[model samples]
Structure formats: structure tokens, C-alpha cells
Target: MTRLYNDPQAFADEMIDGFVAANSRWVRRVSGGVVRATRTEPGTVAVVVGGGSGHYPAFGGLVGRGLAHGAAMGNLFASPSAQQVHTVAATAHRGAGVLFSYGNYAGDVLHFDQAQERLRAEGIECRTVRVTDDISSAPADRADQRRGIAGDLTVFKVAGAAADAGYDLDGVVRVAERANERTRSFGVAFSGCTLPGADAPLFTVPEGRMGVGMGIHGEPGIHEADVPSADGLAELLVSSLLGEVPQSVDTVRGARVGVILNGLGSVKYEELFVVYRRVAQLLAEAELEVVDPEVGELVTSFDMAGVSLTLFWLDDELERLWGAPCDTPAYRKGALEPAELIDDTELAAETAAEIPPATAASRQVADVAVAALATMSRTIDEHVDELGRMDAIAGDGDHGIGMQRGVHAAVDAARAAHAAQAGAGTVLALAGDAWADRAGGTSGALWGAILRAVATEVGDERVPDAAALARGMRAATDAVLRFGAVVGDKTMVDALVPFADELETAVGDGAGITAAWARAADAAAAAAAASADLMPRMGRARPHAEKSLGTPDPGAHSFALLMRAVLTTTTNGRNAS
Candidate 1:
């Protein structure tokens, strides 16, 4: 069963019970799990929000201090009943009035509309503000119908601040609407989520793919695409948001802005920062001044592997309210220095030094290696499913995917260069470029560094024998460990260290190049298999400690597999001769 709950009805009750238990001083359930927070001052404009239960700190948990005055909790992935909405509104209503704000979803509209009518009959002045910031969800002419995601926080923050500042109901509603207008959000989900008591996820996404425009409650996305690097994904998300809003501060006429990088449940802070680095770069390029930036799980779907980006365009009034003190369990504004540009001169010098001068003989060897790696790319791809499933037992299941993607990209680069010029060294240089360009994450960078180090060693050489190959392997190994810091960490080093050691021993024993390669490959494969019993000592799996036991390190396994493929191909060629 995908969900952990015992039954469907018990889901709502359990959630409300926990919420009130934890926040008894500020919030309580009136009826049907409709949560209300006592206003600090009576007759102040009441800001009410409600939505499905899974989006916590959204409509409910946001109901304190400088946020919502009342939160009408709904069932899992379902809108609250009209009765529940009305009950919460009545409890929060003072002599002044009430303002209802929520995402632009069909169920929300239906229930909130019913509650508005009922509250008006009881002499409570009520108004509604809809959050419609997802540009991917609707056409330009119908942007008002877009779904709200992380942008809800900006709406509630500005609206609640208005109410706290003693704005009347109409004024509060106006400021809330203005905040909604200035905000835009978009999200990409790598996987779906399961609701309480459900046997299946609310939606499904194919592995190694990302669904752009996926909804908060595991709704299907607008389209699915191959998962790109964090930088590429950040560009896609930020560009889409900028397309909807103004691209520059000049276009916004020097308006202050707030950027929120929100993780949907399961994405960790490390991955979020990878995405945020690109986001800050993009915003600076656009010349927009970020008044406040937030990064974390402000809103989430249960265990969804995804992230959402929200941008709030700010004027003087919104900026003042944004800076207003807020002390909540989830939202906070801390002191931050202005963003600064990073110096790239050192990086430029390093890149120039890394690129080797092209030569004919070196090109041929590089081409052959790239082709060999490409031929084994499918093997890596096939292993990804098994590796991921195994990793889920102990580590995150990304090893197979990462290696396959990095190798395929390297192979494609080599083939393209070989096609352009049949010469040998051109292919190797091209493969190195491809590996550097397409590979991502720590493994990708390490793999790219290894290839580049090999290229530098073989620069302009027509033929590399056992000694030259041994030298290149040693250099590559040193570069990988230097950059990755995975030596003796039970990672790829398990396979790589043995392979390098065997190659050096074979060379000292005067073994032929082919014999040395065969022995090294076998030793590497054996070392990789033996690592299954060793504990993971590095990367994300380190925290789990013993959990990674019995699961072979993905990096080690890939290295072993690649060694086997290269050796098998070389030995077969010798036998045929």
C-alpha cells in the first residue's frame, strides 16, 4: 500500500488531532476539522485559508502570528465541505469582516463560494482572493485559471500582515489580491505521491523523467521530459517564471522581489541548493533585486520528489509587510546580505589548462574508447532499474541513471566528432567535451575529470603502449580521488584502486598490454563485488550507515562493468586475430 493510514476517514481525523495537539496555544478545531486561531485583537480583519490536508503550513499550519487567522482543513486531496468552511469562518469572524484566500482549484471554488454566502447571511462581511500563479497550467488569456503552488505563502504573508496592521476587510482583500498578482510559481516532479489510506500514488511518473507543471496533490503534469542537470532544470523553471512576470528590475521599475525555492517533501536541502545556485544567477542576470529569498520545505506533498519556484514582485507596501516580523513554525525572514557576483578568472584559467591540443593518433584512441563506452551505455541503462531498487534499500537510487547518462553523453560526443573528422585525437577531445558538458552531480564531475586527465596525458601521442596506458590510468585515478575524495571510502575506489594496482603489477612483471588489461579487469570486477559487504563511508548513504550494507556501491559497480566491457572487447579482438 502506498499510503500509511489505516483507513480513509481516519486520515483527516489523525491529521487534525496532531495539528491541534502540537499547536493548542494558537489553534483549535471548531467542527469537521476546521481550525481557527484566536485573533490577537477582536474586530480585526480575519484572513481565512483552506485547502486539502496534505499541503501543510499552507491553509492550516500557517494560521498563527503574521499569517492566516483561520484555516479550514479539508480531506486528503479533497476540498473541505461547505459546512467546515463556514464553521471556521464564523469562529474567526469579528465585527469587521472576513477575507477568504486559496488556490484556484475547482473544489476550493465550490466550497469557498458556498461558505461565503452562508457567512454573509450571518452579517459577516466576506471576500475571496484566488491564487493563480502557475504559468504552465493555463494559456496566457486564461492565466487566472492556473493552479497555485508555493506562491500561496506570499499571498498569506502579505494578507496576514495587512490584517495585523489594522486594515479593514476591503483593504486586506485588496493587498492580498495584489500579492497574488505579483506572484508566479512553477514546479517539476520526479515522482508521484500517495494520499492517506491509498494503495497507489495519486499520479505516476516514469523513472529518470520529470513532469513539468505537476500539481501539489500529485496531479499529472503538463509534459514529461528527460531529467536534466540541476542547472538546466533551474534555467527551465526560472525562464518560465520570468516569461510570466517582468524579466528585469527596470521592467518592474525597480520593484523589490522575493524568490522562494521550495522542496516538495522528499527532496533534501543538498539538492535544493544545487538548484538555488542557478536560480540566484538567473535572477542577477535579469537585474531583479531579491528583497527576501527563502529555501526549504515551506509547502509540500507527502514524499513527492520535486521542487517549486515562486517569485513575488514587490512594491513598497508589500516590501514593508514582507519585512514585518514573523515567527511561525515554517516561515521566517532572517538577516541577509545582498547577493554578490563570483570571480570566474581562476575558473577560466583552469579550463584553458585542461583542454589538450588536438593530434591525429590521440584522436583515434579517444574515438575507440568513446565507442566502447557508448556500446556499453545500454548495459549501464539496463542496470539502472536494478541498481535504483537496490539503492532504495540503502541509498538513493540514482547511481545507474547517473552513469548511463554520463557515458551516453560521452559516447555521443565522440561519435559526432569522429563523423565530422575520421582522425583519432578529434574524437577523444570531443568525448571529453561531452562528458564535461552533460554529466552532473559528484559522479559526473569525477568521470569528466578522469577523461580529461587521460586526454592531457595522451596529448599528441600516436600510439600508447602498456607503460603509457599505466601512466594515464594512474593520473586519472589520482584526479578522480583528488576531486571526489572517495579513496578507501568503499565507493568506485573499490574497483578503481584494484584495477590500477593490477595494471602496475602486470607492467612490472613485463606482461603484454592485453594480458595486463584482462587481469586488471578481473581484479576490478572482483573488488566491486566484494564491496557489497562493506559499509558505505561517503556521500548520501553515509548517514544510513549500516543500511547500505549488502548493497553494492553504484559507482563501484559501474566502474567494474565498464572495465569488463573494455576487456572483453579487447580480448575478443586478439582471439579473432
Candidate 2:
């Protein structure tokens, strides 16, 4: 369990600041994550690797020479927002293009893909290679759907090494993809991890039992079984990974592979050495040559009692790249000569954006928006635990915390904007940015989109009527749909689409905005409940779709709850009366 935290909502940000402070020689705090403190040669491919926090040494810790040029760290167990990724990539990019790498998770895909598109549009040339090395997440035929676990180190290391070796963007991408294809990982947990201030861990294992095929985000394993001895566990992980040799590797015999025996969190180094002893013996008996084996907490879930083994099947080129000299905060390989430190001015200071002027009518509307946000924040606070419980059934249990952080940030931004006499549209837009920036997950991105659409419809100059609001709702629906989730995908879009449709229908028939919204909220609530019957077809829950059955989709449920909460604001101005 997490024991130390000043504010659970502020944990990630604080951790980043502290990490940079301690490792200023290797990394400096950037807007989103960290960048290499040392200067890089111009036209060198900038390798930007990252994912959710709690996996140290993996992200920010890996930022330095012969490693990641930058890392886009997200909130705990959540992928970074598109804006976050863009900022890190832009900050890291020199004359050469940027190479973005991370775990193959839904939120990471959505945000990184968006950021990639944005950079390409700006002619910054960005490419991405998602690590899919977890054997438990998908079958061999669908390996592309697997999650990235501790094997992320191998991919990141090789990519960074290749980039430092002066590979162009295309070459760097090819080598990184090859590294990912050649890597395989399997993990197990004796217990789950707890977030700061959370009453309990995300999931738990039975006493004397171990969860097999566990994820790094405190996601429970695919199955549970009695705990095995060190030798037995080693046999299980080794045999499981050995069964799926990359097609490029003709056979396991005589194949040179780099091994990582990673502790998830609470597992001590001595205990890992005990397991690795058996692991090393097993690999040797199988006639596989181990190269530069690493054993420790390379990637972790906060205090999770878990371990994962990764085998990177290396060819000649990969071996060369893997042996390259590099230095970073957490993980240091062969030492290399240090370069000049980056000037402070080279880094941009994060400043609040100035709000555009608005009329008194628009400012009045902004005040109403602020009140609605306050109500939404309260609703999230009340239901946060329930939402997290539902999400924990099949997904990483961070929904409640993520929502809490996002809404709190949104509330703060909206209040500031309202005080500055910003228009309703500008207020909502700033709030949306804050939400996505702070929360940083699929839900955060979608909510930002929803708010941005509505803000556009209700511009700073005009007081939008019901028809305009309905149009904004329709636009929000389309914005979500563009993310590729359909009506039955068991995402927030499921409830959002129905709510928008119902509101549009009610407004078309001459109903007031309040009445229309009430009807829509009713539709959303019903849709959210009906979602209990669905097996998640998207997002993290998809891998354990069966487990999610009979539980309402967390995103949909939260969306419904917010919808009804907003109605309270409409019923009574400021929802305080």
C-alpha cells in the first residue's frame, strides 16, 4: 500500500518534481515529463518514450544519453494526454524527427496517435512504436493486442541506442519494431498495489495464492492459483515465454537473449535474486545464452508484490545496440562521456493562457458554467469509489481517482476563468484543457473533446439557445464517435450518444433547455444501467471482457452521473439554492 503522499491528486506532479530535483544531471522537468539535461547532437532521432507513472526507471528515469531524449509521463496508471505528448515531443525534437514509444494500451494509443498526427501536420515528422510484449494479454495470433509490461525496457533501450547510433527516423522505427517483435514477457503477483490515500489495493489475491499473468497497473491476473516455489514459478514463466519464440528466431537452442527479472514493487532484491537463480539455471539448461541479464525493480506498480520476466531475443544488430553505452538517473549502463547541460532558457515555462475579453452576458453565462462544474465535481467526489470499484473488475482501478483529479483541475480552471470575466465557451475550453491535462486517460481525452465541442457551439460572443446547445451536443457525440467507439462499445459514448439524441429530440419538440436536459439525463442513466449486460468491446476491459459482464461500464456510469448532476445546476441556478 502507498504510505506517503501530500495530496493523492497531486502525487504524480510532485513525484516528477522530486525526481528531477534528485536527478538533475540526467533529467530536467519539462512541461509534460522530463527531457535529457545534456545536449544532443543536431539531426539525431529524438527517442521519446513514456507511459503512466508508477513505472519508474521506465519513463523519466530513462531520460538521458543513449536512452530516451524525452518522456511523456502521465498520471498513475493512465497514459499521457495528446497535449502532453505533443509538448514533450516538440521540446525534444531537434532537426531530426521524433520517435514516440510506449506500452500498447488503449489510452496510450489514442493520445499518442493524436499527438503523432498533430506533429506530422506541423511537419515535425513523428513516428510511434507501441510495445506489445505481454504474453498474457492476447493469444499468439493477436500478439499486437497484448500490453507492454517490463519488456518496455528492452524496446526503449534498443530504440534509444539506435537513435544515438544516428539512425534516421525510418531506421530507428524499423529497429524498434524489430526489438518489440522479438521481446516476450510474463508476470505474476502475490498481491495488488494501492494508490496513495486509497483505502485498499486495486485488486487482491487470496491468501497463499498468486495471481498469474498480472498487469503492471495493479490489474488482477488472468487467473489465480496456489503460490509456487521459486523453482516452480521460474519454470512457469520460462516455459510460457519459451513456447512463443519469435518467428525470426529459428529455435531457442543457441539463441542469445537478454533477460530481465523485474520486481513489480514490494519484492525485495534478495528475493528476486532467489528467483533469478532458478531462472538463470533454467535458461542455461535450455541451451539459451543469456546476455546482460537485469534483475531488480526496473518497472513497478506502487508497492505491488509482483515479478515479471522478459526475454529479448537479440540478433547481431540488436546485440550491438543493446550493448551501447548510456547513462540515466535510475538505470545506468556502460558509461559515456558527458555532454554540456541544456540551458534553462531552452526549456519553456508553463504559464496560464490569457482569457479573451467577453461581454457581461457572456460573463454571466460563464458564472453558470462554473456552478455546473462545481456540481459535477461534488458528484464525482460522492461516486468516485463506486466508479473505481466497477472499473477494477476488468480495468486498472484508477477511474475514480482519475475523474477526481480531472474534475478538481477543471473546477479550478473554470473558477479562474469565470473570475477573469471569460465567456462561457472560453471557460469550458480552459476547463477541458485542465481536465485532460491532469487526468490523462481515455475518459479525460473524451471529456475534453465533449467540452471543446460545446464550447465551440456556444462561442464567446453569443448566448447559445436550446437549439444551439442541442447542436453542440450533437457535435460532442460526433467528436466521441470519431474516436472509433460505436454505440454498443460500452464506453462513455454509449450513454453520451443516447443522451444527446434524447436531448435533441426533446428540444426539437419545443421543450425548454432544462426539460430537454432532464430527459437526456434520464436516457443516459438508463443507458448506463443497461450497459451492465454488455461485455466491453474496447479499452482495457476488453482483455477481460467476460469479467466485466454484469458491471456497468465505469465511463458510461460516470458520464450519466455527471449528466444528472448538471441538471441540478439547471434546476436551481448555481445548484446551491
User: TM-score of the candidate numbered 2?
Assistant: 0.98
C-alpha lDDT of all candidate models, in order: 0.71, 0.90
Q: What's every prediction's RMSD, in angstroms?
A: 23.9, 1.5
User: Per-residue CA lDDT of candidate 2, range 1-577, in tens?
Assistant: 7888998888999999999999999888888899999999999999998888988877998899998999999999888888899889988998789999999988888888889999999999988899999999889999888999998999999999999988999999999999999999999999888888899999888999998998998665789988999989999999999988999998779999999999999999999999999999999999999999999989998888998999999999999998888899988888798589999798866777999988777787888889899999999999999999999999988999999988998999999988888999999999998898888888888888899899999878777788888999999899889988998888898899999999999999999888889999999999999999998888888888998889999999999999999999989954211
lDDT of 1 at 560: 82
Clashing pairs in 1: 362-425, 363-424, 363-425, 364-424, 364-425
Tens digit of per-residue lDDT, candidate 1, span 1-577:
2445665545666878877778765566665443333435767888888776777767677876667877877655555656567767777776689889888765566567767988898888899998887776666676676777899889988998899789998889888988888888999999877654434454567989998887776555667899999999899998888887633234653556899999998899999999999999988888778877988887788778899999999888988887776644456554323322222221112122133454566556655665566656767766756654554444434455445555777787767666554344445555654554333344555566567676666555566678777787788889766644465576788888889889989988998778888888889988888888988666545534476677677778788888777776666553211
Clashes of each: 5, 0
